[model samples]
Target: MTDLTELGVAAIRDGVAAGSFTAVEVATAFNANVAAAQAALNAFIVATPDKALDAAAKTDKARAANKPLGKLGGVPIGMKDLFATAGTQTTAASHILEGFIPPYESTVSQKLWDAGAGMLGKLNLDQFAMGSSNETSYFGNVVSPWRRNDGGNASLAPGGSSGGSSSAVSARLCPAATGTDTGGSIRQPAAFTGISGIKPTYGRCSRWGIVAFASSLDQAGPMARDVRDCAIMLEAMAGFDAKDSTSLDMAVPAWEAGLSPDMRGKKVGIPREYRMDGMDADVAKSWDDGIAWLKDAGAEVVDINLPHTRYALPAYYIIAPAEASSNLARYDGVRYGLRDLPEGAGLQDMYAATRAAGFGAEVKRRILIGTYVLSAGFYDAYYTQAQKVRALIARDFEQAFQQCDVILAPTAPSAAFALGDKTADPLSMYLNDVFAVPASLAGLPAMSVPAGLNREGLPLGLQIIGRPFDEQGVLNAGLAIESRAGFTAKPERWW
Candidate 1:
């Protein structure tokens, strides 16, 4: 029997097309892997084997009928918890939304299904997509299948919000998974897990049914083992949606078909702002290696400055939470999900009690901060100022793009840390996103490619950021890094 779980999106598509194996066989293999790894990785909140088998059956029927296979035909993938999957529970790793299953599907997931992808299940994530580490998940923090090289057995985090997606993809529990990047959720996790992930330019993927984290920053992308797989999945996930006012009304480019190792005449930018105080030596070295790889691939290396980078993290916290406060307001106990109503309590009392009991600590903290910043008295002083700073940050990217085609930097300051290492200090946890947040604030396309492993054998990622709606350029640059880095390390099957 073939180890169908080891095949990537492109390989699976070709195999299925060639009748090397039935789609049902592929789905069965992955479903069993997901079931076995659930306890150890905590990757999936729920497993939907029936859905996978059903989709795979359809693919088999189409092949039997001599119909053209869909772009992702017969490939099974994991859906992140934030994306509503009609009948399956779509909790964003929060207790408040526990047992809540949307009647509608997220645009991205629906598109993936239309392209013939099967769903293994809804993956876990940080509650409300609020945390930088996976520790904020209500179900439990996801443990990376990876371990230190020198003999320590401490369980490390797979990075936040999209941590489950990263863990599953990295562990080979699934070939690829859908991930949402709101302030680095997708990239950070991908980096930590030694996988490739991309956050398409804002609005590239419709946000209609995906749980809103930061309305502007939350973007759906693919997390996979390599750049080619990410490209294949991303092409199937991105398109315009009339329901989403912010959806980009543009043609979805065939990114996978355009994948080329040739980087002749491309200028890769190394931002001076990314060199921070107290930076990890390993991360710095990995970044230097990435630059060398790009140069070797025939791309010109240039130095660029994004002066407003320092203000990005602060501005992001403000803007994202403000938008989150507004979007999450609909989740009050009155409509759907958990509702804690004290006996004889009035409407206001019920609302207060429900929220207090239902929301996680991190969600509440962000809500409180958001409400305070958007308060009548403080709005101008904080919210308005933050918006101005956000514009400045965007302008900084605009100016820098003139100097180079794409900017390269470390995805995170360091490699994945042990669970609970930074949870106590919220500020410290927030800083993990410092390197990935600026591109998000500017609504540009950014991707993370596993460059190398740290001394401790933990994965480190190099980020590539491109101009708006230029995911093709970003993916091309990533291919250069992917080709040169040749990162093929996988976590030992400790799980």
Candidate 2:
């Protein structure tokens, strides 16, 4: 018998339905693995073993009774802490919401439940999903399982925002997890941890009940060990929801069933602007290899220019923070989450005290930047200009897609760096999302597939960006890379 934790979403579903193993047995094994790693990995903010077991039992019963099982039947997964789960603490890795449990479940989580997926637990993440290294998490940093090959033994960062999701799936705590991408939270972490994650076109997954970061940019997707598993989990996680105004009314496509690695007659665009100055040699080599792999799969590789690419990072910083400033304003002491009322202090004083005590340093920094950019004198200069640049970036993609079906690029500029390497310099930290933000701004689907190992033995990922509503194209491209690259590497389980 194989180790149950090694099986991903699709394998577990088929295995459970075929009676090869009970869903409970799979859940129990993963639950133990999660428990064993919790102290070292800190991947999960809260562990709900009972919830997993309970859901598995139901799945097993459904199978025994010959009833129809949902798409995610018998699959247990990690929930990024940003999504509101009933009876579970849904902190965005912020002290402000440390114990805030939503009475209602988020639309995405409910969809997963309806599709028979069980909750493993809420995952740890950057405080308010603000940082690139997961260091800003109130629960503490999510240490990547990968260490450098040089025998340094320095604990590496599992990329931020979705760091815990990346770490857990990479560590085999769960087969898959949910992650929200606002400026590369999903793709960058997947690159760092040697896993697969996809951020579908904007509005593909509902934003309702998920903790707001940047309203327009925050889109949820799946993180898993392979492209097919991501496709399967994504099928279950995405759908139109009336609760969210931005929700796509379009029907959810059968991404898993539609999974095809064949890229015959497909055109893969290589953005000339992606070749950065001072790029890591290993990362550059990986990009080269990805191009060769797509070619091997019969994709025509052509260089395309996205002239606005240079402005993407700056525009993202402005737009995302501006929206975040408005979205996070609800966390005042007057309502839910945290309250720190001073003795005999008025509302204004209490608001100041509570916010000061509640938010983390990075969260505060972003809020201030957000507030400043959206200020009276600077709104047109920063926010409005950024919005215009965003439109230009989208136009660039639209024009590029005319010549190519999908675009290939490096997921991040470099491999997993030592934790805290860029914490002192905010600009360096923000640069981590340089490759990923352009796609997020265009509201396009992008995926990160493990490409190969860097010289230091850390995994590097290749990204596939597709036209809007073409996740299938991105997944197929990812599969082409996944097969040709033969990226079977997982982090050595030091934790």
Candidate 3:
């Protein structure tokens, strides 16, 4: 093997379990890669080498004592900064919570640790997980490890909210990383970076200590280089938590053990609404390729229409921001990270000043949009209507699911675009999630698996969405595509 860092979650766990290599060896190799690549990739906001080493020590001792290893034994992964890890500064990449370290760990992170995973560090993300690109991070934007073959060598966006998680996994800095999807944050970034990520059904993973973006839409999952690794990591991350009111009280399934790519007797649906005019040629071709792949896997392909899909993006924009506005109100100058108290000001002035100074441009924009939509005069005209659209979108998926086991679509409108390509145009940036938001609105389990490379040598991905609590079906569809697509291209290590 070239390096321990090249191993994925399952490989690393089995390797450590069998005494082929020590957990410390794997952790050390990944820690070095993370340190060496930080300047160029900006993937991590903080690096916790000691945390990894400490976890490895415990694992090594457990093995020596013949103690049973957990599901993710010996793997070190990135914790997206949105999760509140005990004693680790958990910023949602926002200045408002710059140095705020929670006394308690997030339920998801705790679950990972319980399953023998170690935290390499907290990863960077769009500030408050708000933007489509990683540019909104207060720490700085994360650059993809990829560069186009067109010779300009202009940096590309790694995709947002979960950009740091995607970049780190793609670069082999970590085997897999935690990612939360509010509106395509996990799947879109996974598609952009040529990796696999799943956003489980809403409430599948507890939202207890995750920095809230959209209360009902945000769901945590895993990002890895391939489908099986994502399955393994997700199995470790998902479970019930009483602390979160929205947490599913049902038992977590054995998803990793249940994974299979065989699609015999499975019906795959191609959403007719997704084949819109002006779709990129590369994206359209990849969708076609995905259809053929599922067919080759012995699955039957059929046409399905999600009539409300055209309204998904608009509805998402309204609902997510509106929820974010309500969730973010607790970050006042009184209790937390950034307290911008002017010498002669009262509480309300401090609240205004702190928010103005602490929030990024995109965050403020969303907050204003949210506040405006939730206003007394416009609430029914905007937020209420958006919720109704969301319900329609969900019903559309429910009806479509009756005709098929899973739905296939393109992950994004295009492959990874240049860093500044849509920065000046917010609407253009929002369109990147057009193909991804419908599933989020339905609160379904969805995934993105790398399909192939575009003409520019950047990757394109195919999305598989399944019914609620049906992540196994989504992962299986993704596996069928992963095996056939043979997406072995990794970003060249420029850092």
Best by lDDT: 2
lDDT of 2 by residue, 467-494 (tens): 9999999999999999999888877777
Q: Residue 488 in model 2: shift from native, Å?
A: 0.9
Per-residue lDDT of candidate 3, residues 1-495 (tens digit): 558888889899999999999898999999999999999999999999999999998899899999999988899999999999999999999999998989999999999999999999999999999987899999998999989987778989999989999999999999999999999999999999999999999999999999999998999999999999988888878888889998888888888889888999999999999999989999999999999999999999999999999999999999998998888899897888999999999989999999999999999999899999999999999999999999999999999999999999999999988888899999999999999999999999999999999999999999999999999999999999999999999998878
- Every model's TM-score: 0.99, 0.99, 0.99
Provide the clashing-pair count of each candidate structure. 0, 0, 0
What does candidate 1's lDDT look like per residue over 38-102, in tens digits? 99889999999999999999999999999988999999999999999999998999888999989
lDDT of each: 0.92, 0.94, 0.93
Query: Whole-model lDDT, candidate 2?
Result: 0.94
- Give the Cα-based TM-score of candidate 1 against the true structure: 0.99
RMSD of each: 0.8, 0.7, 0.8
Q: Which ten residues in a row are the worst by lDDT in model 1?
A: 1-10
**Model 2, residue 237: displacement in angstroms?**
0.8
